[model samples]
Target: METFAEVLIILVVLTNLKLLGSSRATACIRTVAAQGVLLAALPLVTSGDAITLRMIAQALVSGTLKAFVLPFLLLRATRGARAGRELAPFVGYTTSILLGVALMPLALALGRKLGVTGPAGADLLAPAALFTLLVGLLIIVCRKQAVTLVVGYLAMENGIYAMGLAFAQREPLLVEMGILLDVFAAVFVMGLVARHIHREFDTLDTDRLSSLKG
Candidate 1:
């Protein structure tokens, strides 16, 4: 079971790297959806039969909504947008990958220092969660597309979810349900805003939305 959790954490981290490096909007959305599925499966991997039915149901809802519905909506919005070019990243691909590589050891060190003791200890969960969180932050900072930012947001949520799974027994099912609900609401609002941005600016570049500056 520990091995399974580690594998899922690796998969999640790899998917985050893909999301960071990929230029195509469709490809990024698909990758984010894949991350969501991995997050949904994470609970199962770490479960110790102490998990309740309500928690299981919450996980299912989170998986379906995050993995399928949210990404589907984002893809549809992407199609509506006129911009088809790869995302204009503030940092080049090679630089971003290098930064991600550099950040890995930092994340591991941070995890070790934090000494987060879960059912599996910090060995599997903490470093991966920290790395994913950093990748999400990098994406949010560098990507100029709203869709890409949303993907980054989802990546951050994935990291949080991974961390939450570490304490799945202590976490209330209602809290998980609320988190999913918040994510759903956020995605819905972002989709609407994406559509509006496409309609108004004739493009989806997030930089352009800042024209109201004084």
Candidate 2:
């Protein structure tokens, strides 16, 4: 089980890097969708004797929203905006990957110091969760486009959700539901803003949104 979670975490992190480096908006969106699906599967893969009805419900809701609904919304937004090329990254692709590599050790050290325990068979979840969180933060900081930024945000949220599954003893269904609702609302607003950006600037590049500079 630990190995499974580790594999999923690695896949998630790789997808984050792909999103950061890819020039095609469509490709980035697809990678985000894939990350969502992998995250959704984590619960089932790590389930042990402690599994409960509430946990299952939480996982279902999370998987449905993060994996299916959120991606569907983003895909629609991408199609509507007709965003093609990725804008210039604040940090280049190679630099971002290097930074990610540098950050991994810090994440591992933090997880080790914290010594978070997961299910009986799944002990590696802590370090993987920490790494995913760090990667998500890097994506948010380095990507300029609104869609890409949202993807980063979602990645971060997924990391948190993964941690909750790994560590939280009790299922916080209400909190989980609230977070999903907030994410949905945020995605709706972002889609509107993306449409407006395309309408006003003729591009989705964040660098190009500085027309009001003093």
Candidate 3:
């Protein structure tokens, strides 16, 4: 169980780097979906031998939304907007990757310093979660596309969900459900706004929004 948790955490960390380095919007979306699948498995590993039906339900919901439903929504939004790769970013792709690499150690150090503990099988969850959050924030700040920002938001939510899974046995099921619902609503609203922005500007690039201030 510990090995499974460690592998999942490592995969999550790699996805974070992939998100930072990827320029193609489709690729970024896929990475986020992959992360979702990984996060969904956390409940099983974290639960160890005491897995419950409620945990299974949560994992199913999380995987479906983060892996399939949310990505489908973003893909539809992307097609409507005619957006693909970001092309150019506020931070270059290579630099962004390097930054992510730098952030890994920092996240670990921070996690250790904070002494945030997790369930038996999820010891590495805190650092992995922190790294994912930072990567998502980087995507939001450094990328220019509205779709990319949406993906970043999802990634950030994944991180939060991962942290929750680390302590799954203690957290209430209702709280997790609420968080999932809120995320769905947020993505729905953001997708609509992104579609509108594309229609109005004829582009999904958010940098173009600066011209609207006149």
Best-fitting candidate, scored by TM-score: 3
lDDT of 1: 0.79
The candidate 1 region of ten consecutive residues with least summed lDDT is 164-173
lDDT of each: 0.79, 0.74, 0.85
RMSD of each: 1.8, 2.2, 1.6
- How well is each residue in 138-195 modelled by candidate 3, as lDDT tens digits? 8999999999999999888888777666544445778778888888889888988888
Predicted structure with the largest lDDT when compared to the true one: 3
Give the Å error, residue 154, model 3.
1.1
Q: How does model 3 fare in lDDT?
A: 0.85
Instruction: Give the TM-score ranking, best first.
Output: 3, 1, 2
Compared with the true structure, what per-residue lDDT tens digits does model 1 show for residues 1-214? 7788778888988987787678877888899899889878776667657677865777689789977899888988898575455545788777887888888899889877777766652366777888888888888888888888888898888887776665544466576677788998998899889888888888888888775866
Q: Candidate 3 regions off by >4 Å?
A: 168-170, 211-214
Question: Comparing 1 and 3 by lDDT, which wins?
Answer: 3
Error of 2 at 204 (Å): 0.8
Candidate 2 local lDDT, 70-107, one digit each (tens): 87777676765657766578887788888888877887
